[model samples]
Target: MTESKLRDIRWIFILLAAYFALQVGVRLATSHSLDLDEAEQVFRSQWLAAGYGPQPPFYNWLQYTVFQITGVSLAALSVVKNLLLFISYLLYGLTARLVLRDKALVAISTLGLLTIPQMVFEMQRDLTHTVAVFFSASIFFYGFIRSLKQPSLASYLIAGIGIGFGLLAKYNFAILPAAALIAALADARLRPRIFERRLALTAAVALIITLPHLFWLKDNLDFATARTLEKMTASDNASYPMQVAMGVSSLALAVISFAGLTVAVFATVFGKKLRSALAAQSEWTRLLERMMLVFLTGILLLIVFGGAAGIKDRWLVPMLFIVPLYFCLKIEAAGEETDKAFRRFMPIVTVIMIGVPAALYGSVATARFSGHYERLNRPYAGMLEILRKQAEPAAILAGDSLLAGNLRQDIPDIHVLSMDYPGFKPDISGRRPLLLVWLIPHKGENEALPPAMAQWLRANLGVSAPEALVIGVPYVYGRGDDSYRFGYAWVHPPS
Candidate 1:
C-alpha cells in the first residue's frame, strides 16, 4: 500500500473511534432510563446462560463480561454497543481494502455505511442482537474474502471463528455463510479452496465454538425460538394467498428501506458515473452478486414454505451489508475518477455522524415541549429512589421487561425479575422483603397490580392478593400534569 493510502486508512479508523466515543457520551447525557433493547440487556445480564429467550446468547454474553469489568451502568452498556459498531465498520474497511484496488473506493465504501438508516440511526437508537449480527457478519465477510484471496491456515481459521460467532449472534445469520459457500463453489477458481484440507480447520473451529450453545438449544428449543417463530408468522391469520402477498410486499419494502438511502446518496453524488458503472463487472463483483442472489432466494423460499409473514428490515442487515462495497467496486471497474466523489461524500457523512447523536439527545431533551415521551424520558431514577426509601427489598418483580430492566440498572445489587421472561427465576422465596412493580399508563387509571404480575406473585410467593402502593413522579422533562404513575407492593418478610 502507498503511504498516502495507509495514512487515509489510519484517519478513517481514528474518525470511526471518535464517532463511536461521541455516541457513548450522547447516550450517557440522554437520560437515566434504558430503551427496550438496552433494558433487555440489563435484565438478562444478571445471569450468564447458554441461551436467553428468542435471541442468541453472544451479545448478552459480551454484555455480561463488560458488566463484570465496568459494573452494570449506562456507560458500560453504551461502550459495549459502540465498541461493536466501531469494530464492524473497521472490519468492513479491511474487507473493502482486500477487494478494491483504490484507497478512495475503500474509504467511500466504508463511509457509505453511514448512509444506511438502519445501521446509522436504528441500530444506534435501540438494537442489540441485530448489532451483534452486523459485527459478526463483518468478521465473516472479511475472513471469507481474505481466505479466498490468500488461502492460508490462519485465514481459514479466522473464517471458522467468524462462522461460529455469527451463528451465536442471531439465528438468521446462518444464511450468510450458506450463501457465501454457494457463491464460492460457483466460481471455478474459488471452488478449489472449498475442497481444500484447510476447510476442515474452519469447520472444526466453528463447531467447537458453537457446540455448547447447540446442546442448550436442543434442550430448550421452544424457549429459544418461541418469540422469533411468533414474529415470523404474525400474519398467519390471513388467508394463504393473502399471507403470501403480504410476505412478498414486506420483503420488497424491507429491501427498499435497507438499501434505498445508500443507492440514492451514491446516485446523487456520483451522478452519471455511478449509473454507467452498473454495466461493469469483475470476479469479485460476480461473487458478491451471486451471494446476494442466493441469500434473497433463501429468504423467498422461507416466505413460501416456512410461513415467515413478517419480514423486518433490520433482519436483512447482515445479508445486504455488502451493497456499499459492491457499488464502489462497480465505480472502480468503470474507471471513474473517485477523488471528486469522495470529496462530495465526506460532507454528507459528516453531517449524519453529527446529526444522529444530536437527534438522540434532542428526542429526550425536548420531550416536554413536544408532549412526546420516548423510553429515555421515563423518570426511572426518581421512581427507584422512592421505591428504595419505602423498603430495601431483596428482590424486585416487575410487570414487564422494560420496568424490570430499568429497575435492575438503577439498583444493580438487587435481584430483578420480569413477568415477560419466566424462564429466568431467581430465588426470592426466603423471608425477605419483595417489591412488586408495574406501570400505570394514564392519569386516573386503576392502580391495581397488572394481572400477569398478580398471577406470578400468587404462583411464586403464595400471595393471593397484594395491595398496591401508588406513586406519581414527573417525567424527566415534563410539565406538572405529565407524571408517570407507578404502583408497587412492598411485601415484608413474615416474622
Candidate 2:
C-alpha cells in the first residue's frame, strides 16, 4: 500500500473506533430500560442454551459471554454490539481492498456503509441478531475473497469459521454462502475452488461448529421454527394468489427500503459517473452481481412456493451489504476520479454519524416536553426504587421480557422471571416473598393483575387472589404529574 493509502486506512480505523465508542456512550446515557431486542438478550442471557427461541444462538452466546465478565450491565450490552459492528466494518474494508485497486474506492466502500440507514441508525439503536449476521457476513466475504485471490489454507479456514458462525447467528444467513457457491460455480476460473480437496476442511469445520445446535434444533423443532413460520405465512389466510402477490410486493418494498438510501447517496455524490459505472463490468464485479442475483432469486422462490408473506428490510443486511463495495468496484472499472465524489460524500456521512447518536439522546432527553415516552424514557429505576422501599422480594415475576429484563438489570442478584419465557422456570416456589409485576396501561383508574400473571400466580404459587399494589413513578425526565404506573403484588410464602 502507498503511504497515502496506509494513512487513509489508519484514519478509517480511527473513525470506526471513535464512532462505536460514541455509540456505547449514547447507549449508557440513553435509559435504564431495555428495548425489545435488548430485553430479549437480557432474558435469554440468564441461561445459556444451544438454541434460544426462533433465532439461532450465536449472538446470544456472545451476549452471555459478555455478561459473564461484566455481570449484565448496560456497558456489557453496548460494548459487545458496538465492538462487533466496528470489526464488521473492518472486515468489509478488507474485502473491498481485495476486489478494488484504488485506495480511495476502498475507503469509500467501507465508509459508504454509513449511507445505509439500517446499519448506521437502526442497528445502533436496538438490534442484536441482525448485527451478528452482518458481522458474520463480513467475515465470510473477506475470507472468501482472500482465499479465491491468494489461495491460502488459513483463508479457507477463516471462510469456514464465517460460515459456521453465520448459520449460528441467523438461519437467514444461509442464503449468502449458497449464493456465493452458485456464483463461483458459474465462473470457469473460480470453479476449481469448489472441487478442491481443501473444501472438505471448510465443510468439516462448519459442520462441527453447527453440529450441537443441529441436535438441539432437532429435538426442539417447533421452538426453533414455529414463530418464524408464523411470520412467513402471516398472510396465508388470504387467497393463494393474493398471498403470492403480497409476498412479492413485500419483498420488493423490502429491497427498496434496504438499498434505496445507498443508491441515492451514490447518485448524488458521483452523479453521471455513477451512472456510467453501471455499464462497466469486470470479472469480480460479475461475480458479485451473480451472487446478488442468486440471493434475490432464492428469496423470490420462497415467496412464491414457500408462502413467505412478511419481509423486513433489516433481514437483507447480510446479502445487500455489498452495495457500496460493488458501486466502488464499478467506479474503479470506469476509470473515474472519486476525489470530488469523496469530498461530497464525506460531509453527508459526517452529518449522519453525528445526527443519529444525537437523535437517540434527544428522543429520551426531551421525552417529557414532547410527551413521547419511548422505552428508554420509562422510569424503570424509579419504579424499582419504590418497590425496594416497600419490601425486598426473593423473586420477581414479570408479564413480559421488557419488564423482566429491566428488573434483572437493576437487581442482578435476585431471581427475575418473565411469563413470556416458559422454559425458564427458576424455583421461585420456596421464595420468602415473590413479587408479581406488570405494566399498568392508564394512569388514573385502579387495575387488577394482568390475566396472564393472575393465572401464573394461582397455578404456580397457589395464590387464588392477591392484593394488587398500583405504583406510579414519574417518567425519567417528566413533570411530576406525568407518571408511569406499575401493578405489583407481593405473595408471601405459605406457612
Candidate 3:
C-alpha cells in the first residue's frame, strides 16, 4: 500500500474512535436504558445453547460469549455493540479502498456512513439488526468485493464464511447471496466466475458452517422461520388493497431515506462535476458499481413481497453500508476540485457527527422532566425489587420479551419464562412459585394486568384473582415525582 493510502486508513481509525467516544459519552450522560432488542440479546446470551426460541443462534452465541468474557451489565452490552460497529466501519473502509482507489473519495465514502440515521443513531441503541447483522453484512460485502475481483479459492472461501456467519446473525443475510447470484447472471463478465470449482467450495463451506444450526433449527421445529412467517402473515383488519398500499409506501420510504443520505454525501463531495466522474470510470469499475445496484434492487423486491406489518426500517440498514462507496464510484469527481469540495465539507460533516448524538442526549435528558419516558428511559431497578419481594418465586413470568429480558439481566439466577410464548413448561415436581410481571407505563390511570397474563394465570395456576401490586420506580434520571408503574401478580405452584 502507498504511504498515502496508509495515512487515509489511519484517518479512518481516528474518526472512528472519535465517533465511538461520542456514542459512549451520550450513553453515559443519559444513562441509556437497553431497548427490548438490546436487552433480548443480552438475555439470550446468558444461556449457552445451539438454539433459543424462534431466533437464529449466532447472535445469542456471540452475546453469551461476550457476557462470559466481560460479565453482564448495561455497560458491557454497550461496549460489545460499539466494538462490533467499529469493526464494520473498518471493514467498509478497507473494501472501499480496494474498489475505489481515489483517496479523497474513499475517505468521504467511509465517514459519510454515519449520515444515515439508521447506521449510527438507531444502531447505537439496537443490538440485533443494527449491531450483529451490520457487522456480518460488512464482512459479507468486503469478501464479496474481493471475490468478485479475483475468483480464487481463498477469496471465495472468505465470502462463504461471511455468508454462513451472516445468516447465523440474521436470516436476512440470505439476501446477500441471492443478490450475488442475480448480479452475476445479469453481468456477462461475472457470470462464468460463478461456475468455477472454488465457487463450489464456497457453497460447501457455507453449508458446513451452517450445518449445526440447521439441525438445531430442525430439532426445534423450525420455530424461528415459523414465527417470522407468522409475523409476515399476521392478520390485519385493513382491506387487501390497503395493506398493499401501506406496504408499498413503507418500502418506498425506507429506500428513499437510505438514498437521500448517499445523495447528500455525493452532492457535498462531487457537486456539479459528478456526471463527468461517472463518464470517465473504466468499464470494470462501472461493472462493480452496477453490482451494488443489482444487490439492492433484488433485496428491496423480496422485502416488499413479504407483506410484513410495520416492517422495521432498520431491516434495510445493511443494504446501505456499502452504498456510499457505490455512489462515490458512480459520481466521484474527475478533477482536483474533489479534494477542495471534501475539504470545504469537512466542517459540515463534523457538525453532523456531533449534532446527532447531542440531539439524542438532549432528548433523553429532558424526558425525565417532561414526565414522558420512552421505553428505554423507564426505570427497571425498582420493579425488579418489587417482583423479588412479592413473589420470592423460583422463576419470573414475564408478559413480554423485553420485560423478561431485563428481569433476567438484572436479577441473577432467575429463570425468566415468557407468558406470551409459553414454550417452557417447567416440570411440576418440587412446585416452585412463579413471579408474574408486566410493565404498565405511567399513563395517569392505574392499568390492570394484561388480559393475556390474566388468562395465563387462570389457565395454569387456577388462580384468577392473583394479588395486584403496583410498584413505582423512578425514571433513571427522574425526580422522585416522575416514575414508572409496574403491575404484578404472584402465582403459587400448581396444586
Candidate 4:
C-alpha cells in the first residue's frame, strides 16, 4: 500500500477508536437496567448448548465465554458489543475498497455508517440480532469479495467460515447467501465463478459448522423457528386486508429509515444536482447496485407475500447499515469530490454519533432524578437482594421472562427459569424450595399484590397465600423517591 493509502486507513482506525471510547463511557455511566432481551442474552450464555430458547446458540456461547473471562457485568457485555462493531466497520471499509479504488471514498463510506441510527445506537446497547448479523454479514461480504477477485482455496475457505458463523449468529443470514447466488447467476462475470470447486468447499464448510445446530433444532422439534414464524405472521383473528396493510406499513418503515438518510446525505453532498450525480455510475457500481436491490427485494417479497403479520423495527437492522455505503458509492459515481463531503459532513456525523450515547445517558440520569418510572431505571440488584433473603430455593421462576432472566444471570447458583418459554417444562418434583416472583406497576407502598399474581401464587404454592412481602428496590437513575416494589411467594417442591 502507498503511504497515502496507509494514512487513510489509519485515520479510519482512529475514528473508530473514538467512537468505541465514547460507547464505553456511555455504557458505564448509563444507569438503565438491561432490557428484557438484553438480560435474557446474558442468562442464555451460561450454558454451551447447541441451541436453546428463542435465539440461536452461537451468540450465547460468545457471551458465555466473555462472562467467563470478564465476569458477568453490563460493561463486559458492552465490551463484546463494541468489539463486534469494530469488526463490522473494518469489514465495511474492506468491502468498499474492493469495488472503489479510491481509498478516500472507502474511508468516507465506512465512517458514514455511524450516521445510521441502527449502526451506532443499537450496536452499543446490546448484542442483539443486528449486532450479530452486522458482523456476520460484513465478514461474509469481505470474504465473498476476496473470493470473487482471487478465486483461491484460502479465499473460499474464509468465505465459507463467514457464511457458517453468520447463519449461526442469526437465522436471517440465510437470506444473504441466497441473494449472492442469484446475483452471480444474473451477472455474466460472476456467473462463471459459480461452478468453481472453491465455491463447493465454501458450502461444505458452512454446512459442517452449522450441522450440530441443525441436529439440535431437529431434536427440539424446531421449536424456536416455529415460534419465530408464528410471530412473523398475523393472528387468525385479523382479516386478510388488515394483515396486508400492517405488513405493508412495516415494509414501509424499513424503507423510510434508509430513504430519509439517503436523501439527506445526497442532498448535503450534491445540493440540487442529486439526480445528475445518481444518474452517472461505472459498470461495477451498477452491478453492486443491482445486487443490493435484488437482496432487498427478496427480503420484502418474502415478508409481504409470505404472510408476515407485521414488521418490528429491529427486524430490518441487519441490512440497514448498508444504506450509507450505497449512498457513498452513488456520491462517488456522481462525479463529486469525496474529500468535500468527508470534510463537511464528517464532523456532523461525529457529533451525532457521540451525542447519541451521551443523550441516552442524560435521559436515564434525568429519569432517575425526576421520580419517573422507566424500564431503564429498574432496580435489578435491589430486587435480587430482596428475593435472596425471602427464600432459599433450588430455582427461581417467574411469569415474566424479563424479570426471571435479569435475576438468573446475577444469581447463577439457582436456575432462573421463565415459565413462558415454549419448551421449558421444569421438573419440579424434587423436595427443594422454589421462589416465584413477578413485577407489577409501582403503585404506592401500601398497594396489594395484583389479584392475578395472588391467584397464581395460591394455585401453584398449594397453600393459603401469606401476606406478600413488598421490597423496595431503587432505580438505577432515580432519586430516593424512585423505586419499584417486587412481590414474592415461596413454593416448596412436591413431596
Q: How much is the lDDT of residue 115 in candidate 4?
A: 65
**Regions more than 4 Å wrong, model 3:** 1-4, 150-152, 219-222, 226-245, 275-281, 296-312, 333-336, 386-393, 425-433, 442-451, 454-465, 491-495
* lDDT for position 214 in model 1: 98
Candidate 4, residue 168: Cα displacement in angstroms equals: 1.7
Model 1 TM-score (2 dp): 0.97
Model 2 misplacement above 4 A:
1-8, 443-446
Q: Order candidates by TM-score, high to low.
A: 1, 2, 4, 3
- Candidate 4 residue lDDT tens string, 406-476: 78657766566665653444555456676767675547544454565556556655555545556677777
Scored by lDDT, the top model is 1
Clashes of 4: 2
What's the residue-level lDDT of 481 in candidate 4? 66
In model 1, pairs of residues that clash are none
Across residues 100-197, which tens digit of lDDT does each residue of candidate 2 receive? Answer: 88878888899999989899989988889999999999988888888788777887888889999999998999999999999999999999988898
- Give all TM-scores, in the order shown: 0.97, 0.97, 0.87, 0.88
lDDT of 4: 0.71
